[model samples]
Target: MNAESRDRLRVTVARSFDHVVMAMTLRGVTYLGEQRAPYNEEYDGNDLVAASHLIAWRGSEPVGVLRLRWFADFAKVERAAVLPTFRRHGVMRALMQEALRYSARRGYRQVLGHAQLNRVAYWRSHGFRVRPGRPSFMFSDYEYVEIEHPLERPANAITMDSDPLAIIRPDGDWDRPGPFDRSLRRAPRKQRRPEELA
Candidate 1:
């Protein structure tokens, strides 16, 4: 790794416009330009959310980006991409480590990812394993091998509220309510009565 990559590797949960722009540029180059995935699939509305974007920067330029979507039991780690020039320079590894740390802090027990078919070994090296009985997910042109990484952390960890990138802040005051578990769940909106509709 170069001195800049090793010494100045900075990872942040991106919410600022400037950082998001840099992240989108890098991801566009890798996922859209090189991989030739459809733009809709690559962008996939993840960047629009505040907390889903994780960017790794060297100085002011973003070199890598990753997205994490939380579910009831585990977090989905996806949309990882690194600029061509920065690949193999430790940008991806730095971003992955940071993502894992953030997940642990959020009290997530596991992190899951769909690693590209060719990049199975890379994900495996980071402690992601193929979940037993689950098959690889196919995405039209390419296949994504499923992988999961368990995070060991205290159940009381409540760091998500303090994270500015989080889309949903914890309910009530963090200091007073004490630690709690939460997952993103949406209930169906109530519709007008049948008579009103008629």
Candidate 2:
């Protein structure tokens, strides 16, 4: 499949409804580890659901993922990940452009994202300005910066029709849990040791 078809990007509300959450988590951990950043294996599907999840797939397999949430006046973009084989083919750019356009349509005045330190310049090229004198999210372990873009009327008004292959369901109701919820709920919790707790 070509890059565009391989991406097969779709926006949805439920992470558990689709099987790509596992692929996204694995790719995130692997990518973060390569950059010497922290990756929590215990991260739950709830985190993915809280944000608007966009997933890209190649045929039946997921290859890229991104998340976005509207907070007051701005839309916060997070967790943009594209597999190594899918990178540099304008995948991330296409995703971001779509997100910005979506945010504008939803009445957001700005779009913001916490850019990993290494990607600051890349974001700058997309018209994001780095804020000065703001507290950093990464603390001392790794460098990270906040980037923001003022959505001009022109860019915000553009819209693209949704893709059919990216459509997981007809009603766009992905918030409901799938088989994972039933299995996790059935699993017994581990008992704590008194000495270990102390």
Candidate 3:
């Protein structure tokens, strides 16, 4: 892709159901259609709970997706997919970088993923390495090995010390005021008298 076109690619958290659907569509095309991965195995019940989806958009086209699930001290990366047509343009790399940044911002120091045996080198290119001594495993007719990447905690990572409003801001959008922040502008409700309550 040209520099101008590459510059148009933006990775953002999937904040709404529509955004999640777009991510699912890319995964469906790549995994379900191309790879013939089983539907149950691919959509493993965890999508809507305790997970953050990242979508890479080249202008208005949703070209790539990555799912991140948070753990106490680590973040698990799963279901990374990019449209076949967009594979050579660094869409996966962009998604990986955004996932790392988002994880670090939330105070996660390690990121883990199950890399298909054939894709180990691709994961390694992004600084992930197979965990030593971990046995290879198989799922959905594919062999996989666990890989991990370490991250340095960012200085601005959210913590108990952060402002309460900042903590409640939308995922990966802590820098801007969110709907809750804007709602603070409304006047407080007046207290009802005992006579009015009766």
Best by TM-score: 3
Clashes of each: 0, 0, 0
Which regions in candidate 2 have their CA more than 4 angstroms from the true location?
Answer: 1-16, 19-23, 26-29, 32-49, 58-61, 132-137, 153-198
Write one digit per residue (lDDT tens) for candidate 3, span 97-169: 9999999999999999999999999899999999999999988788999999999999999999988999999
**Where in model 3 is the C-alpha error above 4 Å?**
1-7, 190-198
Native-vs-model 3 lDDT?
0.93
Q: Per-residue lDDT of 79-168 in model 2, one digit per residue for the tens?
A: 777877777876677667777766675557798888878889999887788877886687436678888988865532323443322223
* lDDT against true structure, model 1: 0.76
Clashing pairs in 1: none
Q: Given candidate 2, what's the lDDT at residue 155?
A: 39
> Highest lDDT among the candidates is held by which one?
3
Give the TM-scores of the predictions, in the order they appear: 0.73, 0.60, 0.91
Superposing every Cα of model 3 onto the true structure, what RMSD results? 3.8
Clashing pairs in 2: none
Model 1 Cα shift for residue 170 (angstroms): 12
